[model samples]
Target: MHHHAFSRRSAGIHSLPVELLTRIFVLGSQFEYLYEDSPFLLKPVQDYSPAEAPNLQVIVSHVCRHWRQVALRTPSLWTTLHFRKISHIQRATMYLSRCSLSGTSNTYLLDILIDTVAEEDYLPGINLYKNELRTIFQAIVPHVRRWRAFHLKICDDDCKAQARQYLSACGPAPSLETLQLYHFTDYRTAQRLYLATYRPPVIVFSNTLPRLKNVSLIGVNLPWDKSPFLQDLHHLELALHLDNIRTPYAYWDRMLRLSPELRTLCLHYSGPKEATAADPALIWPNLDDKIQLRSLQELSVTDLDPDYLCQVIQRLHIPNVNKLTLDLPDQNFTPFVELLTNSAATGSTDNTGRASNTQASSRFHPMEHSSPSTTPPDSPILSLRNLETLIVRALECSPSSLISLLRATQALRVLQVDFSRVGGGLCQIFNQDPGITPSAASLASTGFVHHPLLPLLKIMKVAGTPGKDILNTLHTRHRLSREPPAVSEKWIIGWDEKRRGTDAELDALVDKGYWSFTGQGRKVRVIIETYDDEEEVEEVPDNDAESGDDDELEDEP
Candidate 1:
């Protein structure tokens, strides 16, 4: 009976049109790459092994005669090549040869990933050497013109030197669009010791990549003035850059000006050097003349120096940013707060099509809008009118500043905050009663008004358990509203096991049906997730990559 069912299913799939079947095979081969919150680091879920990787084309070609014909003819299925072990060199060559024989007129572009980092249990009694990597690079370097995306991961110093040699030796890559190079080493320790031996400079394709739009480099340096691929990039990420080989401020300014079409920019402890009088050659931009990044949508700056971060933020004019992530140190949020305050004072539009500064003052009687003393007509304004999602880590700001920031961003839909580093005063805003009157002490001290905050919020994720205050806010928003309530759809709370007794009130609220509102076929969901500690919880990163133990890959043979 099982064999009959399998045969019937197989017949149904085989009866589809040839074009549709080929597309299905092509779509099935594509996989998503997962990264950590820090964009440069890949999520290390398990040990790297070549045998565990997915090979969708090989599986479909070995299934049956009809399926094999369709799979062999689909050229897109053989574009991605993975080389992690010495044994995989043969497989990479096989993929290239299969693409040529797929009966296509034009040459297919390749997306190659070469990981030279050795794992202990990958292959017993065998280690990947420099010559093995060179052999693999030599085989693919000949087809540099047909490369679309190239990713290289090296752990050893010797392999780094060889990779740089091969990259410099290659000629122009006209079709290359994405380039990523990662050195798996702790850059913090290296920076502390000023160790220049482990961190080597990388020069790719001899500055000949014209079509490159996405670039990610971690623990590597490139001569910024000589590289041509750094301009007009759609996505650029640089992390863990050493101070000894820092790029000057002038080059950094020029690069940002050239990349006007950038959509995503992530600078994690990397960018220009700090502005100091000691380096007279490092010319800083004037406050009035800012580099306009009108097309940028997503921006991330993590682990940057506070003074330098302020200088960088003041020099850019980003008006359409919708998603922002900041992982800064405590008491380092003044710059961002000033941006929000200035945006509100400059009469930026709110969600209600009114000036945010006026709306904020009219909605709350006690709160006042404080504008800067001096105003310039042509000053660059960083507007948060279109901001929808915000994620902040290690945020520590005053209550008034936080209030002004929240008022400016009335269109926020999703908010994620690390409450472990926040002060008690900031958390009180979440518990503010929207229906009740404000007390005399509250109005005098914090000038907080009993008004609804973040009315359009749909999802909220808190890194620490927010006990009864969060519950009170949610209940008030749902039950005590004159107009239609904009209650959040989902609230995810990360509970620490150490705070077991403190979450009793939160548990009681959930037991009671505070979230079971049936208004216009809408209901709220509250998710309580428990974790051991910060280190243990952070170790398990996002699993957005293709699963290694997939049933389809296992059943291919």
Candidate 2:
């Protein structure tokens, strides 16, 4: 019986055509390498040995003679090459040789990733020397014309200099589509290095990389004004540069103008330098003529100066943006709040800076406060009507200001807020009966009365211990008789020695069925997660009360 089953399996394997087998091999290789999610550079750098080169191709080729023949004919499977360790040199060469055996005049394009550390901090004894690095580059430099994406990550200053020297002279890359250069160093060290050895910007590619559509540079500076590589990009990420070495607003404006089709822009502690009285000219060209970014869909600005962030927001028009993430650590939220509230007064400006008459009448105007001196009566709130997901961290603002911001996002579907980092009274806005609570009543008197706060919201995620306000909010939403009655809520609580008894309240809520379905036949799913000192605790399963099965809650440590 075993022999007959093996015979049937072998026959089924051989029945597939060579083209289909090759295609399967290609997809398997890509999945092993995570080809679609290439350039995993945003993650924190770790001092570990390089991952073993994916052996999927080699393993399949050794399965049988027929599989070997099919794998040998597929060149695209070997296009992704990584050279992070000394042993990888041999593997890279073998992959390149296989790509050359396609029997075609034009070889397949290459997606290369070079990640290395200095000799002193080498992994175990496998130190990647400068000569070895240069040799690897020399081999790939010949195929620069067929380069599809290049990612370079260096850990120390010496390796950074070596990489810059080689890349500066690599010449024009006609087929290069994505370029990412990251100097991986600790935050303090990077800041010190930039301040100590500040120098004029250097040009990397003398010829414009015409096809380059994505560029990410961290702790690296380029001639922003003259670099042709910054034009027509679809995604741009810049971070960790010191203020003195940062580009001014004019350079950023120029790059935005050149990349009209840019879809994603992320600035982390890096953007136009802040304006000061000593150099007032830095805020040049009259920001009144805002740059229109109609194609921008995702925007993230973190650890930025409030004035600089306000200037950046005021100088652009992102009408179609759907995702926004902001980290506000400062107490001065006036500038940001004013921007959010006054956007509607700009006459509903479109991407072309033309005022549309249709939305002018529908603009949001806050109600008159009893004390007119404290409120801006005619101020129009910004219409972030298209925003669907918002993640706010370390936001310090008044409850009224937070209400105003939430009021603008009528179409929000997902909201994630770190309650530990947020100011007090912001969480109370979720309570259904606003007239009874002072904070909620104050928010209601504002623009929140016309419509519910984020009525279309489907998922609300909060980080911090669960509180009565959050429980009340959940209870109120779940009891509603509306079509979209309730939202799925998740609470992330941090456990520590001092905070051992904090979960008692949450435990009581679960026992009282506050996280279960309401009498109205609407269900509210609640997820409770705990972590201790950045170490994740075991995740509890989602409590789906719809089944009427009560699961006992585990005590968090």
Candidate 3:
């Protein structure tokens, strides 16, 4: 039966054209590379999971003779070359050989990742793995000119020294576009050793590698003055622990001006000091003061002071920015409010449409549209019309401020209200206080105090546990409103709370019909489901690319 089933499945699958099958195999090979469920790069080949055991090239080849021939001919399926342990050194060479086969183009770009440094801590005598690093470097060094994206992450200083020497010897990488050279040790402790020995050559391409774009540097020192690596970057991340060699704000301004096509900018402990002279674009007294990030769409700043973050935000003119993540020392929503409001008012970007003139229905009362006094005079007073997703981790703002923000962002569709770290202020907004039984009719009578809270809010995902008062408020809001904007019984009430064991209230709502509509002659469907934290993980900042002391603000745009 098993043999017959295999034959039936394989018969139809084999009928697909070789071109389509090759594309499928190419995508399958990159399964480990794209979605990183495991740290396969850090582990040896033998330690790979069963899913990753039979790589794309191997899995397709195992099907049949014709499949094996097609897989062998597909050069793209062999582009990625990963080197880790001593046993894999030969495998790296063989893969590169296949990548450079006669059938493929001579200029087929290669994506190389060399992590041969000792995974464990390096002691005095036990550090005999230098040979492994040298072996891998020698095997992969000759093919540097064809590198499309080169990632060298060495934990040991000696390994980095060898790798740096090899990289310097290669001179100009004409095809190299993305470069990530990281010394995976605490920058503070290893500062002395790095300054003494690891003096890498200034990355001057001399008209080579003009297409270079993304670069991520961590604890790796390079002379920025003469380096072409700093130019034409679309996405750049710099997280060096050296306080003395920190790139000043003026330098950052110059760098930004150089990279006109830059889209994504990430800064972690990489900003200039507050006391330093402000950039030309940020000099407030100047008649024309604006930093036009024409192409910038996404930005991530972590571990910087609130003042610095605000200064940076005020300076940048990201008209197309739709997603923003603020991971500051404190949850100060003032800057966010000012930024979003200004972005909406200006309508500088084509993405943020002008606010609709249609007035709110009888469900809410009209109030004065008051913005923070700190906002610039010329700043627009519109909602964050383009912003659809917002993730707040360190939520420490008042309910009034939170509600004010919600009202301003009429186009917001999804909100992840994280209250895991802070106190229970979020709970107070949703769950009216103990003695205060704020009825739905009373809430409706008053209408909306300010602008209606979350007019377009379709999903509300709370990180921590919500109280009975909060749940009741949502129920009442849905029940009272004649046309409850977007809320429906079938609408989702996603819970991402990390508390152990099932809640009695939740179980009652699920098992029995706890949601009651007494005498109203109405029924609603509130489908409760476990919220996957993976959706929120993108908002967090990359710790490896950012400062070690910085908190995580996982976000994606």
Task: List the candidates' TM-scores in order.
Answer: 0.76, 0.76, 0.71
lDDT of 2 by residue, 58-142 (tens): 6676667788777767888777777765756776786787787746415688888787775566764354656667778888887
C-alpha lDDT of all candidate models, in order = 0.63, 0.64, 0.53
> In terms of lDDT, which candidate is stronger, 2 or 3?
2
* Candidate 2: 10-residue stretch with minimal lDDT: 547-556
How does candidate 1 score on lDDT? 0.63
lDDT of model number 3: 0.53
Indicate the residue-level lDDT of 138 in model 1. Answer: 86
Give stretches of model 1 more than 4 Å off.
1-11, 31-55, 85-87, 102-106, 118-132, 186-202, 343-381, 425-427, 432-450, 495-502, 506-513, 516-557
Model 3 lDDT per residue over 19-95, tens place: 99888888787766632432212211112211222255755665567787777678777776655434345555656
**How would you order the candidates by lDDT, starting with the best?**
2, 1, 3
| Each candidate: RMSD | 9.1, 11.7, 11.6
Clashes of each: 0, 0, 15
Task: Report how far residue 284 has shifted in candidate 3, in Å.
Answer: 11
